[model samples]
Target: MKIILSPAKKMITDTDSITPDGLPEFIDKTTEIQKWLKSKSKEELKTIWKCNDKIAEQNFNRLENMDLYHLLTPAVLSYEGIAFQYMAPSVFEDSQFEYVQNHLRILSAFYGVLKPRDGVTPYRLEMQVKVGIGETKNLYEYWGDLFIAENSIENPEDIKGFKRLGYAFRPDLSSEIEYIFERKIETMTR
Candidate 1:
């Protein structure tokens, strides 16, 4: 029962007691997106991110110096937004941590999808951001069904079940985003 989640804008830089089990499965793909982001001018990035000067500059610097292979925190620890705060994975018991690591995945504009224990760096790309990859014009197009396809989950009923679990467990996540996910999941189920 793998559960999909949204990435958080807020992040935690301090080291946690838990060590990340591995790099994200889509590290190579994430690097591809980062390379494109790295190519953009700071102003361009600011406009694309639709953020203020400080956030734009900070994320620009993060993009410039980011080493996808190093200095990574586990996804559960890296995010510090409303949903993650509520989830409180940092204080989970060992068995609970293992359970989450196996059953959870976070969807990202930059990283595609991440396991709970997958290593990640701080960045500020939203799932609906207007960035393009090759001919793709947006994150959703770039991701397509790759995430669902990778998971090999094809049942519409299962997708509905997952959606219900997501809404029930992470009420902090936007209903609009969940609606989009429902549409996407239905598309994948077909």
Candidate 2:
């Protein structure tokens, strides 16, 4: 079974950790997005990133010198959020690493879907950002069902099993074909 995880906003270079197995599946599409990002001014980027001037400047520099292929870090080790800290890839055994490499996928605004060992440079783009690219009005439009279509389950009923992870199916919160799964903070803390 495949498990999808959200990408962290905070990322770091850790080429020393685990070597990336390959590039992201949608590198060509990522290149197109990168080109669009490169065209924006720092101020424009700050707006799009919804970050402070300092963060904007840092990411602006990263954008200017970004190389998608060289000095890459494995996606699992690159992200430095609380979730990643809890997972602690640094201490993972070989068997655990192999399992994650096979089953885990990270969702990214810049790279779309990434395997655990996908080579990725540090980038700052959120899926919710409203930046226009070509004729697309926003990142959601630019991505356009790629995530759902590529990652969809063969049977809709299969998702019900995820409730074991503390998620409750929220039919009231769901819209049309979309299913919303939510867990209480108390459940999450456990």
Candidate 3:
């Protein structure tokens, strides 16, 4: 059973809380992407990032001094978005942490799929970002079905987790390859 999640735009350095289990699965691929990003000029990056001067400059500096291997934080604690804040991984017990490590995966444009405790550095890249990498026109084409296969569910028991999150299994919307979990608006508001 695996619960796939999107990486957050806002991230922070948190090496003090929990140590990372290991580096991402596709570190070499990440290095390749990093090199490609480094080749672009700041103005070019600003255009690619689609941001104003200040944010572009900050990420440009991050690209300049980015070290993929050092001063890493666990992927779960690196993000500062609403979803991550709600997750509240900082207060999780050992059993909860273990469950997350085994069943949760975070999808990243920069690092591919990340386990909960995977070592990660702060970077600004989204799955929808259009950048030429190798022969691919955009990240969607570059990633293809890799993430889908990585997060594919083989066990029927996996469906139980979604129920706990207020998501009901939608058999009408689901097929052999896709499992849809829909939460009602009323349930979400609560």
Whole-model alpha-carbon lDDT for candidate 2:
0.82
Q: Give candidates' CA RMSD values in order.
A: 8.0, 4.5, 6.4
Q: lDDT of all predictions, in order shown?
A: 0.75, 0.82, 0.82
Q: Which lDDT tens digits does candidate 1 get at residues 37-75?
A: 888998889988889999888888888888777767888
Better of 1 and 2 by lDDT: 2
TM-score of 3: 0.78
Model 2, position 138: C-alpha lDDT score: 68
In terms of lDDT, the poorest run of 10 residues in model 2 is: 158-167
Using TM-score as the measure, which candidate wins?
2
Per-residue C-alpha lDDT of model 2 across residues 1-190, encoded as one tens digit per residue: 9877778889999989778898998999899999999999888999989999889999999999999989999999999978789999889988998999889888788998888889999999987676667777667557755754664746665553445323477878877665566755454553
Clashing pairs in 1: none
lDDT of predicted model 3: 0.82
Model 1, residue 93: C-alpha shift (Å)? 1.7
